[model samples]
Target: MDIRPALESDLPELLALESQSFHSDRISRRSFRRWLRHHDRVFLLAVDQGQALGYALVTLRRGTRLARLYSLAVAPQSRGRGVAGALLKAVEQGARDAGALYLRLEVASDNQPAINLYRKLGYQQFGCYEDYYEDHGSALRMEKCIRPYAPGGDSRTLPWLAQTTAFTCGPAALMMAMAGLPGGYRPSPEDEIQLWREATTVFMTSGHGGCHPLGLALAAHRRGFASEAWINIEGPLFLEGVRDENKKRVMRIAHRQFVEQCAAARIPVRHADIDQGQLTERFQAGANILILISTYRLDNMKAPHWVVLSGFDESCLYVHDPDLGDTHPRQAADAQRSALDCQHLPIARDSFNAMSRFGSSRLRAVVIVEAGPGTAPTPAPAT
Candidate 1:
């Protein structure tokens, strides 16, 4: 077995390997030729016994500090044999040598095996797009930062929250608690609400930039509450506000951003249009959940993050905001209105109702799980 730079002679074999490894809509021979012609492109092939086992094609954009893994494939017979891993490592080294700061790729959402492999290799999920692929399957965009090698610190160390119970409140509380300190601290009830707003503000303004949820979600998950976010809005926002040629491009960027956030925190995020019945059906399948209902605060007339959906009784829903604290689980006339206000989305109750009357637009609740019943819950930090 040998790993080496791909030659012109390898194109036919490479194309065959790609077709066998992927579905019908993958890269074509013409596309492969164009990539090979690019000055910054790096294409590597792994062969054993004179047959192509796997291949990787990477393109470096010097000015943008980005290197994209355009195509990667391993023969079906060669899978689970480390061929893919070897090709990936070669691509990483090549990208780094080319002075790229970030490496990016897109994989199908349902491709869990590939997703896990990328995660293990330090690739973080950034976002996803609905029907981004030719077959209309969702695609997950992932990235890996190429930094100068540093020594001494163990990369696998769990975050400080995992080491101690200093910040062990629920998602919202934990985030507000952390905002009290320059680096980390606990906040008062008033401060908690303010901090929660600030943290989420950071997320929205930054376009959800970090590798994980900006504030409370990350803090809580680190301390053992498995928390996730449900993004509810109108039909495929990515597909809206863009030209046909650029729709895929925009969606790819949007999805990559969200997926990276979830990947950073090891949380799952489900994207859905509330009008879709299937979305709500999937949301109800989770356990120990908390729903956040966003609404505009009357004082400012600006939509701010408000209220947590704790649970529901027939005809009425419950919410828990930091401001309300233990006296939460408030009632709302309509559950959909509660969801809309919390998210600050532009859809009106009447308009939303008109579209969702026959169906439900409620966003999926973020599921939270405690470590175990035997373990005592960590106390919140003193304000």
Candidate 2:
């Protein structure tokens, strides 16, 4: 059998196989047609004796380091003969070639055969979707870490933890940075919420609360790590989200309080952008960064986000982004490295600068947490 890219002529056979292989949630001919002509995606066919045995459709979203295996189907005649395995492997290799740090897929919960195959292929279940299919079948979200990622020294390890709540990204990132430092503490979900309570602004664009850079710096300092803050916005932030004048006043009061605590701690607060050059300098100086950025690149939402810059190389900056939702948000892949996992992200130089901000003005803020050296430190904290 020959494995190759699918052509327009293979569409008819593909549609038939898709319909035959699955009882529901099959890709339509129109969608298959679209995938064939799309430049950033790959649609491969396993052919033998001029007949299609299986087909795989994979997607690499723009500005995301994660590729998704959207669809894979093998003809009934070829199922027991390992046609599906070959197609899955080819799509995985294609995703790696496309520079994807990981690949994710959603399969029905009851599809034991597919689930077993995915497990055998090194895909681990990370999430679930209820009633995802038309037949009311729940979906299991599985992910595989695609290898040949950006190489860096093992001395710097930024442990990753997903924010339990959306507004806790800043605190969660601070938690990851602390978890990376020498003698740093490992925080639990409860600890994350507690940290958020201390650092959050109490009000944001539309949510419970979002942590400020000053708040995060203070949070880090209280934990025995030396912290510095750099923010582009001079005045109180998150006030624009509060419509009630009295509520805005309260937010400003809280913001001022956080700043005062930071000042009392002698944390160096700079009113300037933390450009790539400065970021690199800090990395070289042995500092873990908690950057407050906008979530525009991962999603179109112009909101505040926090990520930990754990390591860097000549090609990309490795960070542990706290937010997991909408990490893969585009149809075309970014020319730069994005995220391997929700916690471990690799951002390219130019794309990162654009991603590291909020609103039309692109507000930037970062907290540099520097700690003393340790002997034989591991990249990820031990349980």
Candidate 3:
């Protein structure tokens, strides 16, 4: 069978094949016709002698490097004949031609054959969904990097570590950055806790407090890397409202040690919020920034969380958010494709600043992890 773009005339056969492959969630002919006529979308069919065997539908959004594989179906008679594979290949090419850097799809968890095929094509499982279909079947969301995932590393996929405790965002974010570096640092749970112990303020509003920029940068520096820091708050951060004198004293002592370490190591400290322009300059100069941000802009409840702001452009910031659940939607897509959003999130610059502060102090802190000498710089991807 040959693969080619589907025409309006192919809708009836496309709907038929879709119905054959799906028991409950099949695309209608009307929807297929509309998608066929739309720009930034692709509908392709595998056919022989004018009879369609399979079809795929994909969607592309401007300003996002992601392409969604909304639908893919093959007729039962065409199973095991490579029809679905050919159609998928065509969809990938079409997506890349449309400037998509990633192709993402949601497949039913029970669909082992489809999962196997996708894995065979180098699609990595990045997300999941429960009760995703009309029949309440769960789904696995997968993505293929149409472009290299990062400028340098073991194939652009950053190793993600979920925070074991509420206050390990700093550790988790640093761990991800380490994993992406050339050394392939594999961080363990023990290291996670240790990093927090080394970096955190010990007390904030409640529970264990978040990390300080100097503390986090010092932690990275101790691990054979260089560090620079920019922070808005001075004279003991995260101590806005502690009625107890003892707790305030404890926070101050810890802050003093972190500051002392920075002074000894000569870690550059900027006692102000780094301008967006300066951030761009540092990124281009080959350093990854770890941002301490307020979750209120994302989750509506105010709390500090940490993330690696790995990439940026004039319009957007691309981050590997460690607290996946706390991140807000930069944009919403269907449930299947939504899984990829947490792994690598894109946020508007203006919206990010509004959320990057904490407490009544409006405190903002950043720690820079400088790329090692001779390490490749991250190139901005086309969105």
Candidate 4:
């Protein structure tokens, strides 16, 4: 048997094996077609004598050195013949070649045969879900480090939490940053909404507006953290998307309020963009960063999103992005997101710089939080 990258011509046998291998939660023909063509996806098929034996699909997360084994299926007749193992090994190499340091997957908790195979192949269970499949079966989350561990100046470990709402990335990011600090601030789902309430500027097309750097700094200040803002734009931000005059007026009013509170709190405001070198210097000095980045490269949307910069290395910057929604186009309706793919994501220095700015005006914004009397020391570089 030989393993090879799947082609569109192999779709029929692939779908046939998919149908025979599982009863539910099967990948649709549309998804299969789309995933086959996606630049970030690796779909491999194993065949012998022109007969399909099995297949595996891996997705490379953009702006991160992480990949996910989204799906795997083997023909019933081909079981115990080592086809699955070959396909798995091939995909692991494929993911590594694509620059992914880690590969993660979800297996049914009761599927002992598959679990044993994964264990034999060196995947360890890191987490689990109570009822993940359509049949109410539990799932065991597993991960394998494809690349050798490099020590020093690596990412700092932080709690990985997904925002419950679409517009709550800022709140979720702030919560993660606060959790890593000295204070014992345990952020809950309730705090997510509360922080959004405190920092939101206006209304978004789908929900409330995104948070401003000044607003976030003020929120951090009120919570006893020393915060500072670095923004390139001078006045009322995120107003470019708002069309209603009344809403724009309200946003300006909210922006003015945040600016006033930041001034009264003595939070330093730098009306200029912060370069990567300066960001690295401040971070090494024990500051936590909540940065705004454009989701265009991440999710094909030009909207601003917030994430916590946990640490950096010579080539990549690690961040805890709060959003866990599907990044693939036309796949959200069928995809189930996992937190395993969102934590301590590694983005190349060049890619991070490109995505860190937002909009046609190229607005840049970031909030730096310094450890105060109650906060903890800066997190040690991750291993």
Q: What lDDT tens digits, residue by residue, belong to model 3 across residues 39-106?
A: 76777888889888888888874334557888898889989998878888899999878766678889
Candidate 4: regions farther than 4 A off: 109-125, 135-137, 147-157, 204-207, 243-246, 281-286, 326-331, 381-383
Best by TM-score: 4
lDDT of each: 0.48, 0.76, 0.75, 0.83
lDDT of 1: 0.48
Model 3 pairs in collision: none
lDDT, candidate 1, 189-239, per-residue tens: 554344334333222221321111234444445544455555554232223
TM-score for each model: 0.40, 0.69, 0.60, 0.87
lDDT of 1 at 355: 25
Model 3's number of clashes is 0
> Model 4: what TM-score?
0.87
Order candidates by lDDT, high to low.
4, 2, 3, 1
Q: Across residues 1-383, which tens digit of lDDT does each residue of candidate 2 receive?
A: 88999999998999999988999887888878878887777789999989899999887755556587878999998889998889899989998888777788888899999999999999999677788888998889888877755435324555777776657888788888788778748888887888898888888765677888888888888877888999887878867666878778878999889888987888899998777877767666567888776766665566778888866555566677766563334422322232334544556667777887776556788888877334233332211
Off by over 4 Å in 1: 149-383
